[model samples]
Target: MNEPLRTLPSIDRLLGHPQVQGLLAQFSREAVVDLARQVVEDARATASQGQPVPSLDTLAQRVARLAEHRWRAGPRRVINATGVVLHTNLGRAPLSADALHAMQEVALGYSDLEMDVEEGERGSRQEHVRYLLCALTGAEDALVVNNNASAVLLGLAALARGKEVIVSRGEAVEIGGGFRIPDVLRQSGATLVEVGTTNRTYLSDYENALTPNTSAILRVHRSNFRLLGFTHEPPLGDLVALGHSKGVPVLHDLGSGCLLDTAAFGLAHEPMPQESIRAGADLVFFSGDKLLGAPQAGIVVGKRSLVRMLARHPLARAVRIDKVSLAGLSATLLHYLKGEAVAKIPIWQMLSRPLEGLHQTAHKWQEAIGPRAQVRKGESTIGGGSLPGETLPTWLVALSAEGVPGGAKELARRLRSHTPPVIARIQEEQVVLDPRTVLPDEEQALLAAVRWALGA
Candidate 1:
């Protein structure tokens, strides 16, 4: 046992090996040395336990494989094939090319991020996209924060702290990760006053809840889920009227930000920020990453005085978005302004893509992959908690192979292990990929990944 341990290769010897020299070209010397040490230690431990020691050549191969795994494990791009667009687990929304370019440009060098070039003085970073948001949403002013949750916290803290905020019990919904509206209101230091019953909330309920302690009327959209039977809630116009009757402001938290009328694309209409503004919401807030097809941001747009009040709050500084997010958001808003969102934003493109084209692409994938795959009609959904239970007509390429080693489950796992990992759905004992979610150029990569997954 001692003799085999002594025969184990030294760190210096392994570093100078020809196989390791190749790894040195791709990785730093320090990283290679660290991996070599780990492999050699494993071999020595085996030898000390009176087991057969791996040969130097075998250990060298292990070192190389381990190094490659480490190099490739950090944030590689993944192809979404789960039929869930805006998949929250898969980074929610993919940014447009313009947004990516803008982020890159700002990351490489400094810009007028916080500098007013004309006045030659310091300025607010929020101004970068403030005007654009105001213009697009038709709001008096606009502000942005890290996310929708944070925006709610900031808004409540800024305007309603130490006062009661009246909300409809039906609208106080709990979404993913145990986040509840009542919990957020508690953290904001505001007293929550529930107005109506869970399934039915009438305008009179809101009207009766108003008091001298009431600071604002909080109306939260039930974005993640909905109740169909015997559900009633007051309209925004009516809520605004009641708030004004009591001299209180109305705050609307429109979870997913949608600018385009989704009806034109044959999808259900999602509430837009502009609609909330036009409906007399004193302050309107929504998310940038959802229907907007931009980066993660919490956008607050509405009455100039309310927005300014939120901006001046100390909590605003804590939840403000970074420069990169601002840059990406500004560029994404420009797409809406230029009337090219349907062509440039990936989410809109996928939503509006014709089923006929998707079928054609699925057929081509089926042909390229040979008999191991078959094209079939399937349903795709707009995920990320938007448009729940609604699906779009789409096509899928399903894997059909006999005697698969680990069956569909194993094959699905292996596909995710492929380079740039191909994510797919399992339906009726077959792995399926929707062409609508897969980009045109990524079809080749998807095919190769599928082949590798099937062991063909």
Candidate 2:
């Protein structure tokens, strides 16, 4: 073993090899050295185990394989075969073509992200989309943050820090990724004053909770789950009136933001930002990625004074949205202004797509993949904690390989590892793909990937 360990090539010798040198054009010298170190470590470990030491040529092959793996491990695109629209793990919202183009335009060059072009002076980055958001949501002013959680944190810290913030016990919820209202308030330096029981809350409860130290009343929408059969909560107008009467602001965090009336698409009606603004809520926060169908952003819209206070807060600078997200969000909002969001945005398109269209897609996939694939009626969800207990009827192309080695799991792995990976769900020992979320242009590639997976 010691004899084979001596055969291991030195670091400088490996770095000078043709293959390693070729990698330098694509990867940094430091990165190449790091990868070379990993390969040498692995070979040394094998030799220590009394296994045959790999030759220099074999180590060079290892370097090539390792380099490619590192590249592939970085962010790469994958087809969303899983029916969870707005899939959190899949980067939440897929950008519209216009949004992608807008990001590219800004990313390639600079175009006054935080400068007033006409005035030739430094300006606010929020100006890029502030007017558009205000026009769409009917807010007096709007502010953009990195995400919804940050929006809430900044709002509380600006308005209620060192004061009591009243919230219903029922709305003191822990959202996805363990983000809780009470925890956020704690971070904002605001004291959380819970009112009423977990099942019910009344306007009287909030009124009773208000003190001279109370600065704001917080209303959190239950976006991820529902409390039915006896849940009673104060309406936004009622809370706004109560807060205003006490000289306190009301901040409503509508976790999943919806610009349109979802009931128009036969889905449950979620609270819209415009409705909150109209109802006189002093401040409102919502997510840009969820139902808004844009990049990951948290938008704060409300009375101009309240929003201005938030913008001036020191935390606002720490949680502001980046230029790429700002550009994408601006482009997405433009679709609503043009009265074409339902037809233009991918999330809205999938939500409003006719059942007949999905069935047609499932049939096409079934035909292309042969008997191994079955076209069946299935259900897709408006995932990302937007609409709970409401499922969109979808059609699925289900694949089965019961007799094959490793069965359905092996088939799924092959498709996942395919070039431009195809991600699907497994149910009842079969791989299921809901075409409702798949783009029509991706059909051929999906079929080829499936055929390869099943050895058809």
Write down the TM-score of every candidate: 0.89, 0.93
lDDT values for all models: 0.89, 0.91
Candidate 2, poorest ten consecutive residues by summed lDDT = 69-78
Q: Which stretches of candidate 1 lie over 4 Å from their true place?
A: 1-73
Most accurate candidate by TM-score: 2
Candidate 1's displacement at residue 221, Å, is 1.1
Candidate 2's residue-wise lDDT over 32-150, tens digit each? Answer: 99999999999999889988988787888899998888676657788899988888888877878999999999999987898988999999999988999999999999999999999
Q: After the best TM-score superposition of candidate 1, give how far the Cα of residue 106 lies from its true spot, in angstroms.
A: 0.8
Q: What is the model-wide C-alpha lDDT for candidate 2?
A: 0.91
Residue runs of model 2 more than 4 Å from their true location after superposition: 1-21, 46-61, 72-74
